[model samples]
Target: MDLMARVTAVVGGVMVMLQRVGAPRTQAVGTKPVIPSARKQGIMTLKMPTAKGWASGQLPKTAPGLKVNAFASGLDHPRWIEVLPNGDVLVAEAKEQPNPPKTLMDRATQATMRRARAIGVSANRISLWRDADGDGVAERREVFLEGQNQPFGMALVNGTFYVGNTDGIVAFPYEEGETRLNGPGRKLVEFKPGGHWTRSLIVSPDQSKLYAGVGSLSNIGDQGMQAEEGRAAIWELDLASGAARIFASGLRNPVGMAWEPVTGALWTVVNERDGLGDETPPDYLTSVEEDGFYGWPYCYWGGTVDDRVAQDPQMVSRAITPDYALGGHTASLGLCWMPAGTLPGFSEGMVIGQHGSWNRSVLSGYRLIFVPFENGRPAGPPQDILWGFLSEDEKFSYGRPVGVAIGPDKASLLMADDVGNVIWRITGV
Candidate 1:
């Protein structure tokens, strides 16, 4: 096998070991260190390379004790992936296109449907898989649910599976052997969709609140703040009462989120406002304080006023700048904190998946990164943990990694790729 294939095999092996151990659902929330003088330098940043689609056989040089692997393949737009208590991976595949325009029915409409049939979508469902051994191929594949309209993010809390889409939130009874959703599921809540309608979800550590990340309906529009009634904010939903309220506002488009175990702070990976040429307002990973305004149209990173939307003097005073800016157009998504017992360098750190960029003339991201932490917070720049998925040509990428979760064995990493429809495992040498 080639070098990349070899790495993939090694990573896959580690995953199999984790699966054998029965991936635990015991979360590490509110375990952050209580340090008084931990400094936030805001100086270090990642030097990103332009992305190109590399073949599956190539590999990057290893970092002392690190090993890479390609575990599984052949998926259709797999978005959020979670490891169940029974060693199976649950994946939400948002198969259909978002907000497709409906053409008035006529002879012309039929003709258009015929022409669009080649490019249109068909399969939309949730999948479950088991990897018996640590190698790449899954031993079992089963469909858990079907007919979901653009299902993106998923959270499994105490045997209850919560799925998020553009329109609303839904929940279903989850068990180890229960594949293919048949019974009537409960609809949690609904929201108005607009310009950007991807709803990413994360359940609070206490399991009392469900924080859903809603993107702005329009790119930039005349509706302005009014169109943003529920847009660009992290809406907090009470799980028991089913009450929905805006949690945080003016985030533009917060895609991925995780609760910091040590500090109990909510951190979100934001895909900032686009259309500033290539690099204007940078994408970010920051603490989502309750009721904190992030300055969507009025201000940007570090209190810089945006020229596109003239800032109202009143809104300016309300918006707080981000904690840390990842980079301009980096497309940062899927963040996870390294547990206290995993690895040497990244024990108390963060791992962010850069899904790569589309708006730029040159491609970027498409790699897994490690953000070092000291005490309980991020201390340095994000390092490339798993690369080589991008090639030298920059035309296409072999994989686009989305969600990331640490394996149960405490030694390997589990990554979900929506574009390639595969899950990867990474281990240390």
Candidate 2:
């Protein structure tokens, strides 16, 4: 190894030691309220488990009364899934866009990315998988769209297919049951490029508006507020005119979003800022309100001041408290609501695919969890539905769950395991 490589190894070893000694307070899960406790920022306790492919005949463990199987195997880093009206599953086989290292920190970030298996050339395509036999596996597959940037979120409205690229939203012409698009798509809107790059897109129930989740350019506006112009919040776009406006602000890294079925409220699962120890401001699930701000750099968990940033009492006061905490550094990403009677013992709730954490000693997330809802809000403790992504020793991971969606029949759940390069299907036993 060269100089930087050797340096990274030494630093990684020290970090692992720190993680072993760090004491994380509080069990970070469930719907119950949690108190925010900020820890002093210093050495980052990096604890990413090494990625290990699944062994032969290996599968994720499911909850009781549920069965797990591979929906589509051998995908090229599938990151997101969109179930079409005709029962076709659209998977974005994308990798992170190339962001060359410019500084020492950037180089270190690149090294971390390598350890997480997050660095690679973009596949720049979407694949369509069809399970005509309902046998929990896709029998037919085709390339639906190709030659695009790093695409993540996808949505179809009024026969117009929308894709969320790292830097913008694009739309393509579509017809029911058609396998592929004939031409490159038109760019709907451009976004600022920086730290967090995944753009998650969802359409309004009335199909009149589009909501795009854009993350911040840097952690806590370290790159200046001007660089964060249209980031760290959700954007509302008019589908007809393409006009867009910021719907909410101060969200650090909002990823997965869904509309609450009973209340029609907009909901999101946010991945909070790290370097706050293990138990300080937890990642959260909350209902998004128009013009509301959830504290990012300055505060967290609704008004708990993060001494790391400049204090603004007024801004802190405006920060809205999240509805439920999903534990600190869980990296909670994918969100989808389970309709009534969709799955036994899991109906009328939200399922979150936690891609897992890399910033804490004790690894959190890395599985699928179900949070029950009552009267249109989170009402009970979270139950793990899919787990065992990590190895028995917890030092390596067989897979990490990302985007999740309910199947067209609404009787099964689909999860994108980026590390495993497989889409897993879960159904009632």
Candidate 3:
């Protein structure tokens, strides 16, 4: 375009890099994270490593009593996963659609996303992995489904398989031992697409309904409340009538969901808002209640109002505080329940895949971690399951953990690493 515009863009990018600060170590890891007072920034922090897949001898570090191996590699950005009753596993190779930048801030965001490999042409496909003989390593891989609109999560209930595509939930019939879906599936429910576009899916224990996570279209109603209709919440879908309703509200970006085994309560990991400094409102893990409001544009952590949005006192008063904090800008996106003795040194708890962050100078959540549980609630401090995804200087990401699940063999942990384009399997040493 023009010489002046080019110069202005370069100057703005340089300023962002110069203002970067090391991510401060956070104590925001438990039911009582020490939250600092609000310190908003006129220009949001923007620091991220360029995406570099694992080098020839490179691998992630694991906890002392555990070991990790590449269960499958050379996959497209595999971000979400599902396991079937027949012991097969599925991983969705998806990425963000390239939304053209409309403003200066949008241009900056677009560039950051590109460096992080969080944006690109999505494969728009799902691949199946199999480890017959109950082995930890997958011995077979096949195309299970393809040609979908940025599909993320998958589920198989009864005889129908469901997919959480960006614009809608789709269904296809399946039979035992089949390796692929035959046709374009029928849409079960329509949803607003784009923005925080990953739609994660989980079925009820009894297989009667499915729950999907739809994140907001903008950070804190920047596009106004009307643009956020039926967004930023968990939706429950009835299988019989094909009906869906908001199960919980105000969960800015709830990506991963699991049921607390003992209490049977639904729990989720939510990514909180940005531009409020490094650690004002920590990303969190909390049990979601029916019809409960947890505060998004209006408030956070229960009654703490966000003055950026138009005030809504009554909604703020009714906001529910999350049960535990996971650290600021960690982008904790994947969650799955692991029963007691699933791994050595770890008891029953949730496995979280922290997708990490770009809005903060200091990085958080490039690894996998376990949060201990007692009687179906967060019990104590978290423990690392895998690390070393980031280089020592933190300027390059070899991998970033995302979707997590327990293997059908009931002994190993499976993690999807989008940055490295591999699926990792962890088991006791």
My TM-score estimates for the predictions, one after another, are 0.79, 0.96, 0.95
Candidate 3 structure quality by residue, lDDT tens digits, 339-385: 99999999999999999987675677898999999988899999999
Poorly placed runs, candidate 2 (over 4 Å): 1-10, 19-22
- In terms of lDDT, the best-performing candidate is 3
lDDT of 2 by residue, 1-429 (tens): 346645665786687567556556676665665544566547776666666868889999989998999999999888899999999999998876547788875676567666667766778899999999877899999999998777889999998999998889999989999998868789989987647888899999999999999999877787777788888999999998889999998999999999998899999999988887676668999999999999877888887888877788989989998899999888899999888687777758889999987677677889899999999988888989999999866767899999999986789999999989999999899
Candidate 1: count of backbone clashes, pairs at least 3 residues apart or interchain = 22
lDDT head-to-head 2 vs 3, winner: 3
- Backbone clashes, each candidate: 22, 0, 1
What are the C-alpha RMSDs, in order, of all predicted structures? 12.4, 1.7, 2.5
Candidate numbers, best lDDT first, in rank order = 3, 2, 1
Assess the local accuracy of residue 32 in candidate 1 as a C-alpha lDDT between 0 and 100.
27
Q: What TM-score would you give candidate 1 relative to the actual structure?
A: 0.79
